[model samples]
Target: MTTPELGLPMAVPAQGLPAAVRIYEVGARDGLQNEKGTVPTEVKAEFIHRLADAGLTTIEATSFVHPKWVPQLADAEQLFPRVSELPVALPVLVPNERGLDRALALGARQVAVFASATESFAKANLNRTLDESLAMFEPVVNRAKTEGRHVRGYISMSFGDPWEGAVPIPQVVRVCRALLDMGCDELSLGDTIGVATAGHVRALLSALNEAGVPTHTLGVHFHDTYGQALANTLAALQHGITTVDASAGGLGGCPYAKSATGNLATEDLVWMLRGLGIDTGVDLDRLITTSVWMAEQLGRPSPSRTVRALSHKE
Candidate 1:
């Protein structure tokens, strides 16, 4: 095939694209956690089941946070146990030891912890400074490993922040190293506000590589706030990153950062991967259908370009 025009997206080089990619589906957890309306326990369970049926291998289940903090995911206790039987990794987000304890009691086999790259975001998001937040997660990560569960570390605001703009690569790497050293099996760098460009993505990955962080143990989490998630993802893929985090129907935003918006849609990522010839194990058509059904449940159409395109013909 030839390019319609040698442009930015089509201009993407194939030299570094991975043979396959692993998508970390965050619809059930990250996507809906910030929603204003309460999603029924049954609906959340059904959503995870449908995502698995659509061939998502790793679906973030829910968070074990205090209901007073996040009412939308307050049903984590009831939600996780029901979807625990799904034949995939149902990792829940654990904020501290208490959250971890709750997750362990619910038979969680895998878990994730989040940290921030900037001090301002850390204080706003975790109410702790950078070191304090990492210190808090150390025990959680260590204990989760002791419980024989896998742990994923997330570094939010890796690329940029609403309060502090243009985050330095070294600042992001320090937290990244701490997370990995704390026994996190994998670390995902999140572009929380979606201010990253392709150049920024490549530069950050390069810095991580130079800092001795294995690319194989890293993932990329990009938001579509500026419509740059896929482009950043392509840059990451070319840099040898295989794990990509996405949400079904592009259904997520940072509750803390009002400027931040929904996540990169699963269908859009699948569509790009299909064109790149990288296998994601996701059925795009089925994923689109799932997202469309979910949008109906939310009383709105999906924000995913591919989902909207496929679900409704012009």
Candidate 2:
């Protein structure tokens, strides 16, 4: 396997050494994006602030995509600036050059570009083919680099797609390499339809690593569709990945996945990590409070087993 030339330290420690992992909280964006009711701008900002207080260093704050697509985050202009000044590392999603323009105008220090492993899902989600979606991000990544902003590339449906069945491992590696070649600082592998298994994740990671994608440059975003997210995440951990994306209270869903659900709950992931004696620097109790608050605001019960168990004890 060709080693991924990680210009910086891999999020994981040197190979063969266990390292503490960092969790990227996406509740403020991915979570809220799927909510039936709208979350106010003030409320969004408050939620982000509370997440930061809970010791999450990286937060996926919002997206600058068309308001028509995600009405929940229509206030990108208002929300980006509000989050930029926070001490935490806040990265917003930019769908294209237009979204990048808005995020840059707001002095965004970091931004994300999304692509998909499946052509059908890519077309429906971004209205373009895999090549077109990646091509669209070229200018965004270049401009972001020129301005010294970090760029992250997201490959949705990394494991499986609702429309395309099981994704070919080689194709997944190709799209991931394209994103890396396009100058994205990192690549997030998304199980958008929540169909990933531990073996699937392990196989993909090994393939990507062999194909010259750095394991450290990889992050995992899994959904609990088959109740395999946390287990898959541990498989990634075994391969030396440290950045995992999760939403508080497990708040998200793929619009395309039939009977799909949200990302793994941050609190639940934390619970697992804590049991392993790995330090995440997160205050689980405070996270529970925040998750409960958001669930109340959304009028839905949290999907986190840890949250539910904790609530029962309380």
Candidate 3:
């Protein structure tokens, strides 16, 4: 199966969109974490390097979580140093202070802490209550900040939960506020079950802004289970959000949230951004080539619409 050269999107500038966007690439960490088989550490490192060469400025390398929990990324120690020399922001996910220590030891300059906006998700994912998880993250965020590291807080199930269903705006706001208060430099609002619609996304962003959480400090991480990731992302862009979290080849979903599906594909997101004339500094041809190569490695086709369409696999 030969990969086809993809054409670029026509630039149509939209009103109220940011001049440029920061596409936070998560395929190496969040993308690979849910895979059933362990990807070789060398393959993982090369994946990150290819993404960087594709002009993705920020790539999440790997998670420092215990191997007992996320065995796929158990090679964090071996994987991080392999690509730490890349000229890009390589952020790793740290579950707690212990995870933070592990990442810092590898000279990880940026780290992310995961949280849940719903009680059910907190229990299922973190094995703690909502508040308990926050308390657990407080020191992690504080210490990361004190050590002069950039800390990002991820609030999962922001729009809906499989167990809880339709999450309230205020409930999500409280979690966002708590993370920000704990010295988290930024927060990524996750539509964990992919149940968010465009309207729900707008309402949640409005609520967070009213609750004193600035749009500049927020990012959006959407799943495509409901096929609404692009619409929800458009809503976020209209609200002045410039950061987005995406997985290459649409490779990841939440391990704990079984109903969740692959993340918004970086290629698809970049396609829309290019059409809007919103600069993301991503080279579409190179990015698609990387994703197709990754899909070959996984022995499956890519789930991304753009990847399929470009490769003529659709």
Candidate 4:
């Protein structure tokens, strides 16, 4: 695969690895939102800039939820305009039609709406039942599509919910189907609490496949709370799931689930992908550098093992 040490769309072989995998960088929005203190709008835009400069083609920028809901990302309006000129897709999380309205006004080209397979998480995060949350997102997804924008759906707690020990495969599939039926271009199934193992990963994908959802239309968002994010990611890759959601420097967790830790670190995922001869088009050293700089802003060391090992080697 030929990739500039810094640019994207690297050529990759179709042999054991995926021809190419899209690393959906969710650090700026997801990572920052979970932080204790709010980041300055300038810092957030610069963070997104550095990430895109490192060759992340798609970065989840900011959420359009109310400031009361996510105070860390309260400057969505200010942050979006600053990073609008970047050459990457910036997909923001829109909780409902009102949030979508906010995103539209800012010229958002892509948006994502989230649902939960477990009623416990649904109630906790969306303050609605599982069915009600999906119904709520129906119009939001439809409206985004009508506006010629790319719409993605998310099903949180697909593997396990904090209150619900294990999520049923049927329940997960039902939500996935509903999102796809609602005109979502793709559905990202999240292991929100990160209790997923390789076996569980296979089981969920198998169930989704049997339910007639093609693998191409699916993405996997795995958290590393239990230290199984990479293993679950390998399992998902083996199942032909090419899109993986990760946070830069392992920087995010679900605010509603205090037990949840950071998402799989982008540095870690790229390290594994490169070793497998899979193309991710990310500059590993640059990603580590960016994470290190971001860690400075957060006043802590990064949680990524790859970053830790590589930093010492340097």
Best by TM-score: 3
Between 2 and 4, whose TM-score is larger?
A: 4
TM-scores, one per candidate: 0.95, 0.93, 0.97, 0.94
Lowest summed lDDT window (length 10), candidate 2: 1-10
Model 4 TM-score on a 0 to 1 scale: 0.94
Deviation in Å, model 3, residue 94 alpha carbon: 0.4
lDDT of 3 at 133: 97
Residues 99-144 of candidate 3 have per-residue lDDT tens digits of 9999999999999999999999999888899999999999999999
| Runs in model 1 lying further than 4 Å from the true structure | 1-13
Query: What is the C-alpha lDDT profile of model 2 across 1-314, one tens digit per residue?
Result: 22323221113232452457799899998888877687888888888988888899999999999999888789989887777778989999998889888988887888998889989888988888888888888998998998899999989989888777999999999999999998999999999988899999999999999999989899999999889998998888888888999999999886555556888999989877765555688988888888888788777779898888787522
Cα lDDT tens digits, model 4, 83-118, are: 998999999999999999999999999999988989
Clashing pairs in 2: none
lDDT of each: 0.90, 0.86, 0.93, 0.90
Of candidate 3, the 10-residue stretch with the lowest lDDT total is 1-10
Candidate 3 has what TM-score?
0.97
By TM-score, rank the candidates, best first: 3, 1, 4, 2
lDDT for each residue of candidate 1 in 264-314, tens digit (9 for 90 to 100): 998989888877767789877778888888888888888898887777722
Q: So what's the TM-score on candidate 2?
A: 0.93
